[model samples]
Target: MEPDIATQNDSGQDSESGLSLRWSARLSLTTRILVVNVLAIALLAGGLFYLNNYRDRLTEERLTQARLQLTIVADALSSGDIANRDALVEQFASHLGARLRLYAPDGRKVIDSFELAEPTYQFVDPDAEPLRKDAARMLDKTIESVVFTTQIPNFSEPANDVAGAWSELETAERKSAAVSSVSYAPDRTPVIVAGKSLPDGAGSILLTANARDITRIVRAERASVLLVILVAATISILLSLFLARTIVRPIRKLAVAAVRVRMGRSDEIAIPRMPGRRDEIGQLSRALSDMSAALRHRIDATEAFAADVSHEIKNPLASLRSALEGLERVDDPDLQKQLLDVANDDVRRIDRLINDISDASRVDAELARAKFEPIDIGKMLEQLLAAREQRTSNLGVHIAFARPAKDVAKVMGDGGRLERVFGNLLDNAVSFSPEGGLVEILATPDGDEIVIHIADQGPGVAPDQREQVFQRFHSDRPDGEAFGKHSGLGLAIAKTIVEGHQGEIRILDRDGGESGACFEIRLPKAL
Candidate 1:
């Protein structure tokens, strides 16, 4: 039976030779890694999006501030009345705290605040003052040329240069309009350019301010966000690998161990018992180990049972064969009857042995599936003793029982199996007791457990043979008993049932150095 089970279980697995692997099954590890990185990158993308939007808002805000100043200067220059035009416009530009310039309708440079304030500048007025020596050469390699815009050299050299030269001032007499644009100077400084045509198209006003501060802040912020995202993504990948190693490795180990156990490599192969871990994987490892041990135990027991059954059945078969052979040869009728009687006894013995063996084989399975409940050992014992008294009334031996205190004898187990166990013990005791012997039964609570003692006034078991009495087919019945009266499986089955409930049973020394056997059963009390 054990070999059959092993073969049946492994045959299906071995036959799966074709490796028709599906993507989901084969790519679990890859899936884990991809999932982790995808989530991390998504967060990074969100942060970048936010930074881009923030940069746009800041740029617009700076442009709006420049526009406000440009509008103020344009309105002041276009006022209805004026006196000392150059001085008044210079006062307005100064008060507004911006670099301001005015152009006439013919595109001629009008009032220039930079020229007025810094007359010493070599290129303050391009027509009035000769261009600076370096500016006049228009070289691609000069301090001011490299850092500030070379175009519009009449204005103060800016801190940064735009990417390329700006569009020329074509169509000067085109239309009255206000326009705004952004540019970087040769020094990489951002500049906001605003121009507004004055009321009635009298002239145009232009304003230029360094927007380097805000642009620098935005670039720095972008770099910092990218750096943070890079570091986080790297760390997340490493951590994800560590997590996969911790989880996937143990599971694979368990799978390997199971295959080894199933393939008959060894029964007690070491299983990794990651006891320190309290996670789900840890729990899974432990469960697998436990299941392996249980299956091995069951297989061993099944094989042992098969061997024992074969050995036990052979004896009756041999006797029957001898009786049949004798009956065929015997001449006298009495001798034939004796041989016939011998055959009958052997047949009955074989029947009894087979029945008992069948029950013993199924006991384990039944107990495993049995639902348990709280039972009052005292009440069960009362009923058992009554039944025994009625059955053995005509016999010489009498049975007696002592009830336990209320609630003291309660235990958790299958009531029917527990009853069968005590019944077997009582029957065994009665069979050995002398005529009119008292078979005493007692139940009581012993701390967290309930203890039941069944003592009979019969020959006590030897200390050495006490354990052997509970073994299968261990028949050590007393003399004068009818042949085939007992199958010697009762005590074995009783012990099995007791253990199924996580309880214990043992032969105990009789009180007062008595000449009788005492069986003690202990069970955990029901909560």
Candidate 2:
């Protein structure tokens, strides 16, 4: 079978139809922002944590070294040289100011700085407990394997106004109250706790370190890390905002194009395909191009058909006016009767011609949206037979509705149009049917489709001419082929009206059905 002309429909529909321009999924602006921010923050946090950890370790090593240096110096002073002990400590403290703390064995002070008279020190003995001081606190109770120290600045003895305070210094070995904090507080002497042992007048010594420098370095490093993150965040936020704008702009264009397509203004879309983008936008552009090409083809065909319709209808209208002019001058009784009848026939023919042109033009529309109401094929055929009997009684023709459902054989179709469709079928059957011959109407349901077979027992159409009879202006009448007798459009009109309701009406084999020209109509019950 030849393909039917494709239909184009406006977007009017019921609530069941879910046609629109919007596409919704989990993707949104908020989601995009959240993803970007989370990733940025995680990376920044990781890098900052790593560097802060390293700086803290470095500060601990430096403080440890300084405390070891103090031990070395005190050993030298106790061994023999006390003359330059103060000068030596002053030099060490000044050079290693950031990690300096000073104390003697039994927790006595030779010099103090940073409000640390006697500060606690960390031990790594595994069994060592915290020693409280009124100054720096120990973060780890066990002594570390190595000592690290940066020397504190030089110190001067308090003047006469503080002579009593100075005389009270280091008189007894006493631990201070709880140490408050540990930091890089400048101008502080190194904190040192030494254990002096005398075995047969020979000397032994032990040493410990403070945590002030490690704590201070961590604070400084954390601050610097925060600054870096703030700068990175600002740049990321600006870049993300720009990226979001770029992404959303193309999406908006695609949205408008989709809306135009849904609105039947398919020709209006010219999607803006950005250069070098091979993502979703490129795919969408290709799709829209295909849609536009399809629409343009339909628009061109419709224009051409409109032209053909205008040209075809003009001839009949002119002929109709000429016949009316000729009938106006008739005067004799019998001649007037003949002319009036011919004129009336011309008017009817013109009406039929107009209706045919209109119906053919609307074949697509009807196929696209025609509502199928319940109709009885048998009852409709009965009505057709009863009406055509008056015209056929003189010709000795009998037309019958042959069926399985009998009078209740129902089909779904537009009733009035189906009436016209079958009326034409019966007329064609009777025209080619022999006198005293039978025209049969047969129907059977085939799946979701209904097949109706209309056949006659007269001379069947030739194989070559079977399909030709349905074209516009073709005819099968023997000789009543007057100007308006069979305008060669009856079968064409029948075909148009049938297919318009989403049905296939074709001329099938006559002999295959036991005789004559067999025309079959196959219609979907509903789609």
Which one is best on TM-score? 1
Q: Write the per-residue lDDT of candidate 1 for residues 1-527, one digit (tens) a residue.
A: 34422322345563443653444444777466767686977667466556545655776787777766776667766773555667766666566555566776665667777777743112122245345523422322332343443333222442432211112122222434445666655443456666666777676666666665664575577568768888888787777778778877777787777777777877668567779879998898888778888788779877987888888889889989999998879899998999899899999999999888888888888999999998999988888777766776416787777888777799988999999899889889888899889888888888999989999988899999999999888889888987676777999999999999999999988999999999999999999
The reply for model 2, stretches above 4 Å from the true place, is 1-100, 103-301, 320-345, 373-396, 406-413, 485-490, 497-502, 512-515, 525-527
lDDT (C-alpha) at residue 523 in model 2: 75
Pairing residues by index, what is the TM-score of model 2?
0.50
Kindly give the stretch of ten consecutive residues in candidate 1 with the minimal lDDT sum: 163-172
lDDT of residue 10 for candidate 2: 52
Residue-level lDDT of model 2, residues 1-527, one tens digit each, is 42232122455433343543134234576457756775876678665446544754565465455445544554555565556545554454445442233344333344433233222332323234234321222321111112233323332323532212222222211222111112322223223333332222232222334444554565466567667888877777777777677676677666766556555554555555555678876777667766666666567667865665666667766766776777678667787677667667767777776777676667657656777788877677777667667555326767666656653456677887788788877777877777788888887777877788988886777889987888766656754546665556667767877766668887777755666889999877543
Instruction: Assess each prediction's global lDDT (C-alpha) against the native.
Output: 0.73, 0.58
In Å, residue 183's CA in model 1 sits off its true spot by: 7.8
